[model samples]
Target: MRAVTYDSFAPDNARLRCGEVADPKVGPGQVLIQVRAAAVNPVDWKVMAGGLDGMMDTVFPVIPGWDVAGVVTATGPDTPEFAPGDEVMAYARKDVVQAGTFAEYVAVAAPAVARKPATLDWAQAAGLPLAGLTALRSLDRLAVGPDDVLLVHGAAGGVGSLAVQLGRDRGARVIGTASEGNHAFVRGLGGEPVSYGEGLVQRLRALAPDGVSAVADFVGGQLETTQAVLAEGGRHVSVADPRVEQHGGHWIWVRPDGAELAVLAAAAERGALTVEVARTFPLERTGEAFDASRTGHTRGKLVVTP
Candidate 1:
């Protein structure tokens, strides 16, 4: 099988190479997917740069990717939930950093695989799992609902964009922070857009004078702004910063759950959620995709097709 591999943690993504590797073997409770598309995430490049060295163990010549949209070629014994020819997607992160989704094929534990939303094309589907899951988890933790003003940092970003829509779906009045260029894009996602950076707290206060009822910080380094704008008895969560925990907010890490993913898929099928894909690259050009992701300015996801 042809796939991307990095022999060591290269901060510049210089070690990424595309070549033949042994096909993955299906084990019990696993399903083999023939890759169609995979999404590039900041975590992919961060992992490549050894950013997560003290956390997950890396087996080098590591394959780099987690979000995948593909078709099942086979299922291992005891995996009665799916069979050959099923279209599926998953956040296919392993306990160790190897055998990932940036390949011609990948084998995932059945419990982490969900049926692909038929309404989405391959690129969009590939972009959904991780970002959607992160957004979902953040909102669930904050318990956003009607009568609350939800403030989303990085509103036009991959996860933040989805969080805006999901918050709106739950009847919250969402206020999103983005650059001046992305304010309209955030508005399209059903959020009232506010520019981040200087005077952010004042701007948020102008929108919600009592301060916001909840804050979801998708972009880190905004703890001060979050604390300043949160109303009394409000809640906050951050996927990027752990210090949020010390401030009485939750620091969330997304988990792989097919059942939860299925709920997102159903929402897409119902037209309540959508994925924005910024660009698509071929399998061999994954390094370029990582470069785009590292820029930290793209409004949506970058996808790679095999």
Candidate 2:
């Protein structure tokens, strides 16, 4: 099968190339997917640059992606949850770095796969898994509720956009920080928009003078602002900042869960959620897609169609 692969880490992504590689072997409790679309996240590029070497082992010629939407071609024995021909999406992250979604086919553990939302096309479905999981997990950690006023940092980016909507869906009064250009976009997701940096705390205070009841930092570097605007007993969580823990906030790393993926899919189906695709590239152009994600300012998710 054709895949985007890198044999070694390079800061410039110079080693990433598209070429034929062996098709993955389906293991017990796994399903092999014919990938229709894959989303590129910062982790993909970071992994390509060896940023995660301290965390997980990497096999040579590693395929780099976790977000995939595709059709199941086969399921391994004992995997009764899905069958061949099922349309699915998965945050197919594994314990090791290899056999990723940037290929024509990916072998995902059944526990990590969910039926793709019928309301979303391939690219949109592909974009949802990783970002949606991160947003959902952070919100869960913060325990956002109807009585709460919630703030999301970097609210117009992939994870933050979903966090905004999810906060609204959970009945929180959602406030989000974005650039001036993206204020309307965040508002469309049912969040009140505040521009980030310089006077951000004052801006948030203006929006929620009583103080915000919860904060989810999808963008890093907002610990100070989070500390400033949080209600006395409010909760806070960050997917991007490890320093959050020092301030009595939770730090989150998203885990693959098919059940939670199903919830996100159902929300999209109900029109309560949507995934934004800023740009898409073909499989051969996966390196360019990685470059786009590395820009740190793409308005929405970047997808790769294979």
For model 1 the TM-score comes to: 0.99
TM-score of each: 0.99, 0.99
* Candidate 1: stretches off by over 4 Å: none
lDDT of candidate 2 over 1-306, digit per residue (tens): 999999999997789889899999998999999999999999998888889999999998899999999999999989999999999999999999987999999999999999998899999999999999999999988888899999999899999999999999989999999999998999899999999888888988998999998999987988989999999999999988999999899999999999999999999999999988899999999888888888899887999999
- Quantify all predictions' global Cα lDDT against the true fold: 0.95, 0.93
Best model per lDDT: 1
Each model's RMSD to truth, in Å? 0.7, 0.7
- For 134-156, candidate 1 gives per-residue lDDT tens digits of 99999999999998899999999
Report the lDDT of model 1 for residue 292. 94
Residue 211, candidate 1: alpha-carbon lDDT: 91
